[model samples]
Target: DIDPELKQTYDVMNRLRETIKNRDWPNYNQAFHPLQGCSEEMLAALQTLAAHHDEIGNTFTHHYTNGPLEGSNNKIKVIKRTGFGYRNFFRFRLRVLFAFRVHTKRALITK
Candidate 1:
């Protein structure tokens, strides 16, 4: 059986996820309602959530996300790590461009 405190955490998180998915801003604010005599960790999480309220709401409100750019950055980091760092700036730039190039179609093999 899950602990009561952990269940509360999950329930709060699920509510937020559903709110964002549904773009229900009103309920999003409701999720941050004050709780008394809660665990220290939950209190800390509540503070963080309250701080980033606007940023989180803006995700669904604007329909803009940096997911694609973040993916590209991860790919570039992998290229650098696999090559153990490149000595030339031009070479690194070209490698990133070639990896992300959408003009050419190539089937990648997955293991």
Candidate 2:
């Protein structure tokens, strides 16, 4: 059998996941407060989360994320890696532009 403390820790983590998944902002404090004494690592994480409580809670209020920008960044990384890096910044910029232009054209054609 697992240790009692470890089981409790798992329970807390599961509850926290459920709280976030359900966007239960009002019960966030109740869910998180118990972690302050769960373990040193959990306590430290709790402190950090408390510090950014507003931002964390904002996820429930806002339905947007930086997904598109992150996707673009990933694409740029792939381009840079595949080309083995570029010596000229202007050429790199043009390549990035060209890549996106081709992507857009292909998307339009497929539609």
Candidate 3:
């Protein structure tokens, strides 16, 4: 079995994660209010989480995310690195745009 302290810490953190995911403030407060003398690492983490409580709450309140935008940026950066052989800057730009702008499926024609 894990050390009791470690197990307690894990239980507390797991409860915290579930409360955050569910946006249950009452449960979160119950789980978080007793962090007085946990291990030093947990204390530090608690401080960080306390400082960002509003931001963390905001995170759970919104379903929107910048994940897709970050993915697109990563794709563009990779293309930029490997596209040096393009004849010109505009041509390279076009290639990148085409990669993103092209339709995966053609439209049906019914005349």
Write the residue-wise lDDT of candidate 2 on 55-84 in tens digits: 998898899999999999999999999989
Candidate 1, residues 17-92, lDDT tens digits: the string is: 8987799989889976746444678778779988988797787579888899998889989999998989887677
Q: Write the per-residue lDDT of candidate 3 for residues 1-111, one digit (tens) a residue.
A: 457777767777898989987888778878887664467788788889889988877776777888999999999888988876776766676667677985433321111
Each prediction's RMSD over C-alphas, in Å, is 7.0, 5.5, 5.8
Ranking by lDDT: 2, 3, 1
- Model 1 pairs in collision: none
lDDT of 3: 0.76
lDDT measured at residue 21 in model 3 versus the true structure, 0 to 100: 77
Q: Please tell me which predicted candidate would have the highest TM-score against the true structure.
A: 3
Give me the runs in candidate 1 sitting further than 4 Å from their true place.
1-14, 87-91, 102-111
Candidate 3 residue 27 C-alpha distance from true site, Å: 2.4
lDDT of 3 at 78: 89
Order of candidate numbers by TM-score, starting with the best? 3, 2, 1
Q: lDDT per prediction?
A: 0.75, 0.78, 0.76
Clashes of 3: 0
- Taking all chains together, each candidate's TM-score versus the true structure is 0.64, 0.69, 0.75
Please say which candidate is ahead in TM-score: 1 or 2.
2
